[model samples]
Target chain A: MTVPPGRRERKKAATRQKIAGTALRLFLERGYDAVGIREVAAEADVAVTTLFSHFASKEALVFEQDEDFEQRLTQAVTGRAPHEPLIPALRREIQALVRHCTADSAAPIWRMIDESPALRKYEESMRLRHAETLATAIAADPELSQTATASRTIARFVIDAYSLAREAADPEAAVDEIFRMIEAAWEVTCPSRRA
Target chain B: MTVPPGRRERKKAATRQKIAGTALRLFLERGYDAVGIREVAAEADVAVTTLFSHFASKEALVFEQDEDFEQRLTQAVTGRAPHEPLIPALRREIQALVRHCTADSAAPIWRMIDESPALRKYEESMRLRHAETLATAIAADPELSQTATASRTIARFVIDAYSLAREAADPEAAVDEIFRMIEAAWEVTCPSRRA
Candidate 1:
């Protein structure tokens, strides 16, 4: 039951995509450090203010999917099928994210991020923000019955799983292995779930 | 057996301490962002090169104990009492660290770190590096016999405990609560420990 975006919204979305695509192309061609926001805006045929309006900073441009990534994580908790276990839902989402980022097409962008101190720092703080958002969503679910501490702890662990799996030699296997540990951790918080 | 440092080594240590103390004072007096590296060196009465030699960056001065922190975590694993369970040993170490950072004396330093984006990012990366070193120490213990993934996952959970607890309302209690989850996570990886 969602309304379709009107023309104005559609145009704005298109502009954002074009700017992000153009910025990524320029960053990859030249070094991230070498490229300026002005250059990105000029090459994208947008004003400097327009670029800033869409993205908060140069680092934000590189992490074009930051908001989407955060939303997906929280939704995995809030949008799961009723009574389905929490850790598995989170594991499935993390597995998908690891796959998306580790795909061959995404290699160059990650390499560029790893090489830039600015980008790496931005990504770390971005992950912390996502973890906090996920914690809030988890705490809001009455059925989960987690204490504030438990909710925050589980959220951080889920975020850690995604990050650690992404860097592992085998991302899929790493997700399963880490999720087993998370499942055990989660279950310990539920005394009723134990024999 | 431990030997005291020679005079030259003692002098080098004193110089390093003076530079770090001076830098921290300036960073606190002026905002971290307002203070510059050259100003720190000048105030400390060291050549710019001498300051650079002792500390890698402005951020490094803020985290002067980074190496010591990493070493202590690794030593918690590699130098534990024989037959001591891994999770408890790590829990003890993490508790100590949380207490150290949460002390009233350390509040200003941590406040400075939280207020500065550069310092926060630096701390995140430093935590990751410490986790890796702890993982290596855990994996190398023949008695533990964990897979590489398990060792790494546990290492991250321990590091997360320290961080989450440091920010919690009751830091000491948070450390204990998170360690309970970590203990459960670690036990799952050790099939032999269960009936």
Candidate 2:
């Protein structure tokens, strides 16, 4: 899916981010309902039609940040260190977040999404999609499909724990707190789950 | 919130279940959107107004059975065996459901819910509320909130795992599989997680 490193793709990506950034700022400053699509389009310097081309609806535009962590998760679980069980690999992923925190990252998006029920519901739907991606990825493996439910269940738990931590912490501390909680859950599930 | 177990409350409960049973049978046999609320009211032998009294939406009438589990979960988590950790206690509660499985119980309900996106979204929202309820209960324990994020994160993970196990099982074997995955996750987190 990687577009070749060229101006067209880069410009498209930047325009997409611009619309998102503008939309988020407007939603935060006023409210999700207070802002209109035309305003966002104008602010982002894209035509309204172009903005809608990038996103199906205002809800989709607001929820654009809900990315495929499941893809990263699939990467984490499938690309584990030799002999490592899925749980430990996931535990390490959660822990790494705590060791390094990024404030100008996805936190504001989550914060804004959390503030609105429509957005929260959209994100929850997105969460189901993410879980499916995880389950589907695991189910694809010959050794994983039959046994994958358990691993996927554990993955869901890790992801859920990671979510709660990310939501509750101050941005600077979100990563570490998130990782610490996941590691604790990891310990409870895999008593020997190590860093 | 406990209504006194008098004739009126019992009668109301019976009426509610009857409406739900009627709606579910209709939703499964007919497409959820294909059937109208008037048809459901007619079949349930209740006025449309009466059916609406019991459920906020037709969706609620079809999903009435699910609301009880979260109430039970909140009760169970708050009142676990004195010696057990929260996750194992939660696992045992799910384990208890195996005995409740029947040829005419939750299996059909689960199947119907799985097939609909609206229902799936509704169920996830319900699960988040359940997680929040359990989190609030756990947070009340002074020792937990003092730690800031770990306790709430653990509550959400445990709830997520419970939700996963519930959704992933074979219909006939769902109860057993859910608890089994739960116990497995518990063991992975806590090697000694036991009955």
Candidate 3:
């Protein structure tokens, strides 16, 4: 059901990956701020203009994967059955994403983000933006549309819960624990429906 | 039951206030990073050492009120009646704090925080720290002790709910709405207790 990229698209994707990898390496070796865009482009054997075309900014380069994650979240929420509630859909989708993050390939990128203050800030801001977007989706539901502020808070809570789960030593155990805690939280906040 | 400050203690408090006010004014006019400790002392008519005695660093000066807020949260949580449930106690305590923050005098300080990236980051980091401390308090309760991660997530949820309420046009109304949202969230997460 998915279309494969043509030759030009494949080459463009390869160039972007190369540039980002090189930039991350330079950032790790020296420091994020110390590494110049020009240097990263040179090291990656790409033109500065080409690098800029691929990524709007250095921060964008580092956080390129975040877009995909956000998209998945949007799809998970919007594509759910009309009767499905927002919170459960979010929990299931984010848990899958969190599980993927625990894979071997994600370690380096996670470390890169952990070590850089700029990246950390970027990540935090992106998270807030994502929550806002998700809240809009939640509010689109007729039942939830009336509680706009509450919807925003719910979106934020789900994101924060996932973040906490990810920080745990055993993420899978943590996910189960977080869901239980969320249920407890729900009991006090709303008693009408069992989430 | 509280002891009043002696003459010397009152004078020390006054001096600290003068320095902090002057520092805030300067930071607001110029920028957080642009304003130096020496400049703040000069403006406040205090020596550099005197300012240092009151505040260890520039960031500390900006976040003095935040420390007080955190202390109050700790005291409220720890000082609750032995029979009180953790979630209800926190909800009551933080709602009081949210009311205090809604005062007209507090608007400028909130704006200062909103305007500065450094201050925003400092605020976020403090929120996380407060959540961690509150989580400890929540975990100390026997019923919740077994789920440390859940306690943390609950703590974060409370703090974030408070933040969302504060941003609304009517903070008190928002607080009420947020509590309802929390109940809804609790319903989904844990339906047994109607906290």
Query: What residue runs in model 2 are displaced by over 4 Å at the alpha carbon?
Result: A1-26, A35-58, A78-108, A135-146, A170-195, B1-22, B36-54, B79-88, B98-104, B139-150, B169-195
Model 1 docking grade? medium
Cα displacement (angstroms), candidate 2, residue A195, comes to 12
Pick by lDDT: 2 or 3, better one: 3
Model 3 misplaced stretches (Cα beyond 4 Å):
A1-18, A28-42, A45-61, A115-118, A181-195, B1-19, B29-60, B181-195
DockQ of each: 0.70, 0.31, 0.35
Candidate 2 true-interface contact recovery: 0.37
In model 2, pairs of residues that clash are A98-A175, A98-A176, A187-B189, A188-B189, A188-B190, A189-B188, A189-B189, A189-B190, A190-B188, A190-B189
Candidate 3 structure quality by residue, lDDT tens digits, B20-111: 88998898788777888889999999999999999866777888787778877777777878756655676787789988878888777778
Best by DockQ: 1
Report how far off residue A53 is in candidate 1 (Å): 4.5
Over B51-154, each residue of candidate 2 has an lDDT whose tens digit, in order, gives: 88999887777667665777787777667666556655666666564335333566676677778777787878877887777777766654223244545555
**TM-scores for every candidate against the unseen true structure:** 0.91, 0.69, 0.77
Share of reference contacts found in each model: 0.77, 0.37, 0.52
How does each model score on lDDT?
A: 0.91, 0.66, 0.76
